[model samples]
Target chain A: MNDSLRVVLAMIELELRRLRNDRTEVFTRAVQPVLWLVVFGTVFSQLHAIPTSGIPYVDYITPGVMLQSVLFVAVLYGLTLVWERDTGILKKLLVAPAPRYATVIGRSMSSGVRAIIQVVIIIPVALLLGVSFIPNPAYFVAALAILFVISGGFAALSIIVASLLKTRERFMGIGQALILPLFFASNALYPIASMPRAIQIVAVFNPLTYAVDAVRGLMITGNLALLPLDVAVIALFDILMFAVASLSFRKIIE
Target chain B: MTFAIDARGLEKVYKGNVAALAGVDLDVKAGDIFALLGPNGAGKTTLMRILTTQFKPTSGEAHIFDLDVVRDGAEVRKVIGYVPQETSVWSDINGYENLLIYAKIYGLPSRSRKDVIHDMLESMGLRAPAEHLVKTYSGGMVRKLEIACAMLIRPKILFLDEPTLGLDPAARIAVWEKLVSFKEEFGTTVFFSTHYMDEANAYSDEVAIINTGRMVTSGTADELKHSLRGELIKFSLSDHRVDEHTLGRIRGLEPVKSVVVTDSTLNVTVEDAETALPCVMDALRSEGIPVERITTTKPTLEDVFLWYAGTTRAPGAASSIGRVEGKAGGTRRE
Candidate 1:
């Protein structure tokens, strides 16, 4: 492997080793999205609030909740940078031979892996909720690819924010401030068409909207037409976020 | 070849207008243990950070083996290792894994990486707990492991901000021993910062005392102590307050070389303590400054720091020193 690739993988290895010891984080974080699925899907399915067009309401919300899981895991991964800074781990990595950009990408890549794990956990929950999985293998593969991009984009965004804040209290404070705004601004809980005109306009720009649209289009309804646009936007988001994150990451060492 | 570390007019001022390093010109020779000794917030860390390439100086220049730290930091870092003042480690990871990540960063070949890590663990005397999490290790063990991480690349120069901070006396000695052995084995030029006068005196080949971002004095420990000639007489005040009136009385005593006060403890440098003690006691008794006890001891690094830190302060540092209570401000002591 090349130097940067090996460096990124070494960083990923660090994350994997840490995760190996954190079994509770796996079981609990995975369970969180499922519980949200169970409560909202079960309670809202029969209420007729969502017009699912004869598709089960449980099916309509499952993909949205899975995307939520992706966003939750990816965005919160920034906290580790703050913790690393506090514990002097970031200082160690700063002087390392690898480029700072590699360090940022390595952390975001691990977040992508964690998102994949959550997708697996959410699958069993979808079954319990009477939701149908994607029937076509090609489209399912496409959905997973989209999921990875979504995870990568959000993870990169987390790093950008982490580099700016540089402290847990501030990073988490901003994270908390932005999390609900980003979630509610999107069509995670409802369709953008059903949301008000202003909200719909805002949702047009939220990455979570594209993430949910892509994942839900392929997984819930097998509608792959918008999948291409969704993937394009998320891929663009990942590239843009990674570039901006790399720029900001240099400031950390400064 | 240039000096192992050479810095000229090195200055760093933080964003808040705080000057962490004012103007420091330093030279550390190859294969020597050099200590930057100073009180807390006296720019020791700032100077170390600049030299280690962790931060850029606001002004002036520094070079490690003649590579400009700011412009060629990547090249400099390749040949240098830094152990920061704080615990610069991943505590949740085991000692072996910690070394592995560092080995990879240093681009150690996969074939020799594990062997190098094992050798380092063994050399640091941490092989027994190599697999155990660093969080479970004692303060000394953690420090030693960090030093091993720094040494992973066989750096020609090792920069330690405070290698034995927060360690017990025994643990401090352990870290010192590991450093000593590592130096002997690798001929690495070790540069560490500390407020502990004894740590510098005992371990380093040369010492530099920084006060308020300025290099006040730099020399061998023996030369520094011997700079201030005469015996040191320590007077323990029966009452914990030495009013200015009493201070003047003691300062007026004939044969008193100099008087330095730290709280109620009075250190009087004189040609002879025994001869001066009785005369000083007579003066103090008249002034109602009762003497609890008195003793004479050889001059030490503490006296050396007190001499330099007290004498070399700029106008601004004088007030800061007063708030620091007329002594070295750091909590760590020799």
Candidate 2:
């Protein structure tokens, strides 16, 4: 194979190996979303006064919860960069023959895979919880595409933050603070129309809102029509974040 | 023949206005063990970072085998292996697994990776610990593992930054032996940075002494010692008062370069000690100034360090020699 392809494959292998060794992290990543789906979905389902998009509360929240899980887990990707810097592993890689951009892409891809795995685990649990949806093959593909884009965009944002922050503690602290605000402001917990005017405005601009709306539309109605716009927004965000991330990463490595 | 590494006017300043490296010029010929000796914060790590392409120079240029570190870093990285100061291998993974991951990252041939990994493990004396988690290994073992990872690719030029720090005396010797064998067998150009004067003198074919972000001097160990230009005479005085009249008489002796008086001793820096000692002793005896003990020793690398950098001990360590003039000229003993 060519050099770039080899590097990409190697990076994937490395990530898989690391994931296997940290089985606890993988298990937690899978379990956390299910807990939110079961506990929050049931408790909030009883509150019948809350409005939804012609669906039950559990069903509406399932997609949002899944998207939230993927977004949160993806932050670990950037946090790992901070750990790598402290350990001098990043410096070691910077000296290697691989193109710097390829390294960034490889890491983003790995984070995307982890995000997909979490989504897969959540889907069956969502079904078991009576959160039913139409299974359109086209919608399935679109949902997967949305997951990839959102995960990649979040991972890129993580890398950019990790590169700018000097310490791992600072990175984690700032990452956690940013995550809560982004989730609350997005339509992760409720529909944009039902939210207050100020929060609705915030949700319109939140990238995760696009991801959740797109996935919710697919899982509930199997509608692929609006999937295009959702996918486009997520893709645009990913490209913008990746560009800024790669530039900042290059500066850090340099 | 091309040099393994060449750098000109390489400089780096951190975000806080700390000048880590300031206009360093260096050259290392192929197939030689070159050591850069400096105290901590003397910009050794910064220079290494730039040379490895991990940190960009504020100005100037560096080339590894004709590949520009800035412009052709990707290509430059393929040929060089860097063992960073920190032990960075994944602590949760086994030694063999760590090597496997690194080898794969370097795109080593899949078919040969197993054999290569086994060889590196055995060669680094890590065969028994090959299957053990790195977290279980001792500090010295972890360091050995780092070296093994760097060796997996058989890099043409190897950079080791403070490889033996924190190692016991026996482990330090073992590491040195391994480095020597690696260099001799593979003809790899080895560049290492160290703060230990004795370690540098013992292991380096050529040593570069750096202080305050600049190269103070560079030469073979023997050449540095020879450049000190006089025998060092240290005498233990029975009384602090070896009268000024007697000190004047000792200074008047033939071949005596200079005399320095301290609280409890007299030290003479001389051109020819055999010719000056008897006359100096005769003057002391005539004055009834008792000398409890006397000794003469040849100049050492530490003396050369003291002569050039103006301090007796390494820069970050403790020592009593006040500042030595930072002059760029060679001075001969009288």
Candidate 3:
């Protein structure tokens, strides 16, 4: 493999080892999404307070919860960059013979892999909660692809923030501030139709909106008509985020 | 002769007009253990960063093995392994995983990556704790793992920034032993920046002292100490009667190189303290000066540092020699 590919894989290996060594984060992050699915999904499903396009509220929210978990996990991924820079690990990686952009791409891609662990956990919980996913395996695969793409984009966005903040404490504040707004402003918690007009405008532009739309369509509504547009938008988002992140990655040292 | 590392007029000025490095010119011969010594923020780290391809110089140029650091950064990086002052290894990962990551980055052949990493672990004495998380390892072990990772590919040059800081005496010794063996076994040129005077005095074949973003002096430790010449005859007077007349009389002595008075103590640099001591004593006694105590000692690296770098103070602190009162009071500006 080429150097960039090797670097990307090496970074993924780093995340995998950490996860394998300590599975606590995977388990801990699952708690929020599970709570959302069981408590919020059950309550909202009974009241029928939000429009679900004639589907069970829990099923409509299942894909949204999956995206939420992925978004939450991936958006904070840049914190690791700040932590690494602080600890001097980032300098070690940067000083290597590998391409600089490869480091950014590699670390951001690993965040997607990490967020996948959340999806793996949430699917069974949603299944045990009687939230019916479309039986087609192809749709599930496509949904995972969309989730991974969006997760990579969000992680790259986090890396950009990391380069600017340059401190874990500041990155933490900004990351927490960012994750909630990105989640709430998107259609992850409720339909954009039920959201206010301002939020509707924001949800239209939010990358997470298109991700949730694609995931919700594939896993719940069984709709592929809008899949092409959703994929295009998130792909563009990923490319844009990666470009900005690659440029900002080295600035953490400065 | 072609140097392992060569630079001419390197300058790094950070934002807001902060000049971290100001026209630093350095050359380290291949296979030499060179130590860059300076007080805090003396541009030692900045120069290392530029040479290691971590930062670009604001002006001037540097080359590692003839590859320009900026133009051929990837090529430069391939031939140099850098261990920065910070804890460079991932604390959450095991030692083996840490080395494996570096091995991959260095593009070691996949088939031999494991063996190379295992051998490095054995050499660094980290094999026993290779499976444990780096956080579980002692400070010295983590530092050793970092060095092992850097040596995985055995690059032509290894750059370290404070290779051992905050490490205990034994740990510091352990780190240096590994570095020395690496240098001997691979013939890799080792360039490191450190604040430990003894480490620089004992380990480095050549030492360069920098002060306030400028190179003060560079030579072998013995050469630097010898550059001070002769010996220092320090005597304190009970009466504290040392004035210009007394200083002028000592300066008039044929063997005395320079005279400096600090508080009640007078430090006289002489060509030969043994021959100059009695003359100095007769001069003092004839002048009705009562001596408190007298001692003679050879010039050390610390004296050389003080002679060149002035007092080790915060950057931009007053550079004046207010404590020492004599003609040779302040540090010499090279």
Candidate 4:
């Protein structure tokens, strides 16, 4: 109906069309998280390396792997922006009559769809490894919502990075540098209680920490107590990122 | 009457103080095809970007159909369609899908969107390949598709940057034919930039030559060529007796404006080739020099460009005159 809403929907349609044409990325991207669940989950579960409150190691890390998959897909979304800018696609977009911020919002939202594809792929692999998710459908729906919100925030951050670093080479170096630190510093692979005091502080600031906490609490722990705090932090991250990303979006064309 | 586009003292200074457009002033009439001709890095693209509202000029003002491009960018964008120099169509998507996205972006009515895209594809002769991916199409087809996308909205003005670059001659002709028909059909002002002299000379109603970000001159192609105000007489000497004394005697003749010698060949610009050719011949023959071949021809756009822009040809410029080594004993009209 409205221009911004229309742009977002059009972008989603573009992603769907692209996916329909080639589905290899959705399947190939599933491989890394599957490996984490099968190889790393099995090795750690036998040794009982970290306490999981009696939860199976494979099940405990299933949500983390899903968030990891989503994070990787969303954060790398800016690469598309850089490539588009170099190829002159961005010039056409910027010259259109639509609001400038809508382009950023629309493109970032498409990354959420890409994240959803990764989630669907990981769910099957998790089940294959005998990982159990809470049998509640509402909580399952809530987990997907949380994942989408997390993805929108990370995708916006990726666009901001793209606006700053215009070259693909520079963006790739910085994107890889940002992704691993965000994953390792967060509680995705381990509990923050086992991390050093400095890393604990860093993990508190990392949005991925709150994302994993929400998904892990929703589908695995079924403990909805900290759910409100996790959701608030993630929503706040999303809003802040979208604002900054919208402000800097035009710089990619410059 | 309001011009279709007007720019005054537009200046864009990039980072490190690199001036892409120093100070350009331009105006285009409505429903006319205007060509901005220049060599590479001559600020043609920069000026187009500013006019299209993709980049803000560091200083000065531009208006599209009297709407300020910077202050009212949305309004300007509504009336202008831009085809950038690079290939903007998605290689991964079909031609139809590419048009669909652009149609949505331009806010075309949802109900008519399909019909509009189909008609444009057909008009551009891309209807047969509408379902095929753009990557499979030839370079000319890809260009036509981009033009179709820009024209989908039927904007009042269409801006293209190097629209036919890297296309073969037949493809270039195809692209121009579509543009000409589009202009005639919609009365849309077609503003495009190109370094090719022939395209400018042949297609444009008005042509502006830019050199290093400044507007060198602007007029119809005929006006530019006729501004040289003389005929060129080209002749070569078979005998080696012709020397500076002979060239000076020829320059001293009443009708000769300038004389330039390159190796065995001599180029003489004269008030009238009819009167000057025999005098040149007699001067050479008096020095016991035998003329190999002599011909008189009107000055072409390339000759005009060289006289005004510089003696050297711009890189990648198609030449009507073979490479100019140097001018000698010559007076080039200032």
Candidate 5:
């Protein structure tokens, strides 16, 4: 294999070892999303806290919870950058002849793989709760594709932050600051139109909003409502974020 | 080129006007084990970082094996293995996996990768513990593993930044042995940075002292020690308890550059020990002070460090052996 491919795979393989060493990460990550679906979704379902268009609360929140998990999983990958840099792995890799961007892609790919696992866990649980998958096979594929793209984008973003900050505590502080505000401000928790006027303005720009809307519309409403624009915006954001991430990571290594 | 590493007028200033390197000019011959010595915050690490292609100097140039460190970093990196001061290993991974990862990066033949890893581990005395996670290894073992990883490139030159800073005496000795063996076998250029005076004196074929980001002097350990044109005389008083009167008596002797007393022994720096030793002994004898043991030896790297760092022992004042007096030992600019 080419050096870049080897480097990226090597990084992912290390993460796989860690994941195998501790299955707790997968279990722990599923906790918050599961709670949101079972406890919050069910409790709110009885009260009809927000409109779900007669669809079950679990179904409406399914896309939101998955995207939330992606955000947590993706950005958390970057926070670990602090530990790696502090311990000297980052420098060890930086001195290699392989391209610096390969490391960035490698890290993002690892996060994407972990998020894929999250999606696998959430799907069965969501279905058990009476949440329906997308009717058409093609749309289901589109939802999966959206999940990968958004996950990669957010993961790239975390690496960018980690590169800039160069401290685990600080990266986490920043990542934590981002995940919830982005989740609550977007259409993940409620429809964009239903939110306050100012929130509607912010959610329109939130990548999570596009991601959840695209996934929810595809799998729930079956209309792919705004799916193209949503995909385009998230795709554009991913490209921009990846570019910045590569540049920023390069600066750190250089 | 004769020089494996060279720098001229190299300057590095951090973002907030912090000048880590202030116009450093240095050179190291190929196949030489050159050690850079400095006290903390003397910019040894910064200079190594620049030479290793980890950072850019604000001005001037550095070349590693004929390639400019900045402009031709990709080429420089290929030929130079840099084991930075950080614990340059993944604690979560075992030693063998760490080597294989770098072996891939170094483009080692797939067939030989495992064998190469095994050989390096064995050479570093880590073969028994090679499969254990790095987190479980001792500080020295981890450092040895780091060396093994860096060696995957079979670099023309290896740059180590404080390779044995925290290692115990035995571990440090083990690391030194492997380094020497590697040099002998491969004839690779080894340029390392260290604050440990003893290690530099004991291990390096050549040593350079850096102060405030500038080269103070460069030479063999004996050469640096002899540069000051003096001998270090150490003597323990037979019966006289060390009081200010006794210390002052020794300090009052003319031609003595500095006098340091620890316990009952006195270390004096004088222009020429042969001429000065008898005079000192007679003078003390005349003063009714009995000397038990007196030995005049060549200056140590510690003395050279003190002289270059401007940390001469003050009259009648006993300073710690290694801690240079800050007020006097402030890094000499010129």
Candidate 6:
């Protein structure tokens, strides 16, 4: 295989190995979304006055829960960067002949794959909780693509933050603080129309809103019409974020 | 012979305040073991970091095998293997897995990786612990694994920073032996830094001494020792006070170059101790001053460091031996 492909494959294998060994990470990532889907969905379902569509609360929250999991688990990309810096592995990689871009790409790909695994694990549990997957195979594929793109974008953003920050604790603090605010401001929990006028405008610009809308459309409405635009926007954001991250990382290494 | 690595007027200032390195120059020849000796914070690690392309120089240039570290970092990295002072391995992984991962990062061909991993592990004396998690290994074992990882690439230039810092005596010796064997077998240019003067003198073909972010001197161990003009002799005096006339008399001796009096001892720097010692004793005896003990010792790298760096004896400062000397070995320079 060519060098770039080999690096990507190696990184993927490494991540998978760690995931297998650290069952806690797998369980933690898998459990958070499942709880949100079951407990929150049921509790919120009783409050029909809260204004989700005639669609059951489990169905409404399933997409949001999956997207949140992707966001949360993808933060590991930044944490792993911190870990590598502390351990000196980042220096070792910095001195390698492999292209610098490949380092960022390989890491983002690993995070994206992990996010997909969590999404897959949540799917069955979502079904048992009375949430239905769209019958169309194309819609399922589109949903998967959206998940990868969104996760890749988030992971890239995490890398940029981690590279610019000096310490792991600082990065985690900034990352966690940013995540909750972004999630609350977006249309993840409710439709944009139900939100206030100012928040509706912000939700329109929120990348997560598009991701949640795109995935929810595929998994519930079986609509793939917006799939192209949604995927394109996410891809563009991923590229831009990754470029920024790579530049910052290059500065750090240099 | 072409220099494997050449650095000229290298300067690195972190945060625009801390001067980690200041206009240092180095020429490491191909296929030689060069040791950079210094105390902590002497900029040894910073220089290595810059050479390995982990950090950029604030000014000046470094070239590895004719390739610029900045403009040609990719090419430079292809030929350099750096084992940093810290243990960079993933503690969560097994030794075998760590080596394999590093091999992949070096872009080793898939067919060669398995054999390379096995060979590196065996060479580093980590074959028995290949299956064990790195966190379970001792400090010495972790260091061995790092060396194995760095060697997987079979680099042309190997930079080891404090390679034996925390290792026991036997482990340190084993590491030195492996380094020697590797250098002899592959002709790799090895540049390592150490605080151990004896180890540096014994293992390195040449040593560079750095102090306070500047290069003090660099040369073979024998050349450095021979460059000193006199033997250092000390005499314990019963009284701190010695008459100026008596001190002048000692200075007028045939081979005594200078006499320095401290609180409880008399220090004499002399060219020929055999000729100077009798003259010194005769003067002290005639003056009726009691000499408790007299000792003469060869000039060590530590003495050379003190003469050039103007530093006093301090804890952890003793290891700053092998201080680099400019031509003429002068005490002060602009």
Of the candidates shown, which would achieve the greatest DockQ relative to the real structure?
3
* Model 1 steric clash pairs: none
lDDT values for all models? 0.80, 0.79, 0.85, 0.85, 0.80, 0.80
**Which stretches of candidate 2 lie above 4 Å from their native place?**
A27-32, A50-53, A120-128, A133-149, A196-201, A217-220, B235-294, B310-334
Error of 4 at B313 (Å): 6.8
Tell me the docking grade of candidate 6. Answer: medium
Candidate with more favorable, higher TM-score: 4 or 5? 4
CAPRI band for model 3: medium
The C-alpha stretches of model 3 lying farther than 4 A from their native spots are A195-197, B234-268, B272-294, B312-333
Which of candidates 2 and 5 reaches a greater TM-score?
2
Residue-level error in angstroms, candidate 2, position A55 = 3.3
lDDT by residue (tens digit), candidate 1, B194-277: 878789999999998898998887789987665545566788886578777877877777887667787778877676666777
Regions more than 4 Å wrong, model 4: B235-294, B310-334
How large a fraction of the reference contact set does each model reproduce? Answer: 0.61, 0.64, 0.90, 0.78, 0.58, 0.75
List candidate 5 stretches off by more than 4 Å: A49-54, A134-145, A163-172, A217-231, A250-254, B106-109, B233-293, B310-334
Which residue pairs come into collision in candidate 6?
A: A254-B56, B216-B324, B217-B324, B217-B325
| A148-241 per-residue lDDT for model 4 (tens digits) | 8789889999998888988877877788787889988988888999999999999999999998989998899987888889999998998899
Task: Evaluate candidate 1 and give its CAPRI docking class based on DockQ.
Answer: acceptable
Q: Candidate 6 chain A: minimum summed lDDT over ten consecutive residues — where?
A: A78-87
Task: Classify candidate 5 by CAPRI docking class.
Answer: acceptable
**Residues A1-254, model 1: lDDT tens digits:** 37677777787677777776666787788877888788877899879897776788888878788888888888888656766665667777777767767777777877877787788888987897778887888877777777776787788888888878776668767776767778888877888888889999999999889888888888878776777788778878887988898888766655
lDDT of 3 by residue, B227-302 (tens): 6555778898885768799889988999887777777888887767789999999999988889999988876787
List pairs with backbone clashes in candidate 3.
none
Question: Global lDDT for candidate 5?
Answer: 0.80
Give DockQ for candidates 1 onward, in order: 0.44, 0.56, 0.72, 0.70, 0.45, 0.62
What are the per-residue Cα lDDT tens digits for candidate 5 across A167-186?
55566579888798989998
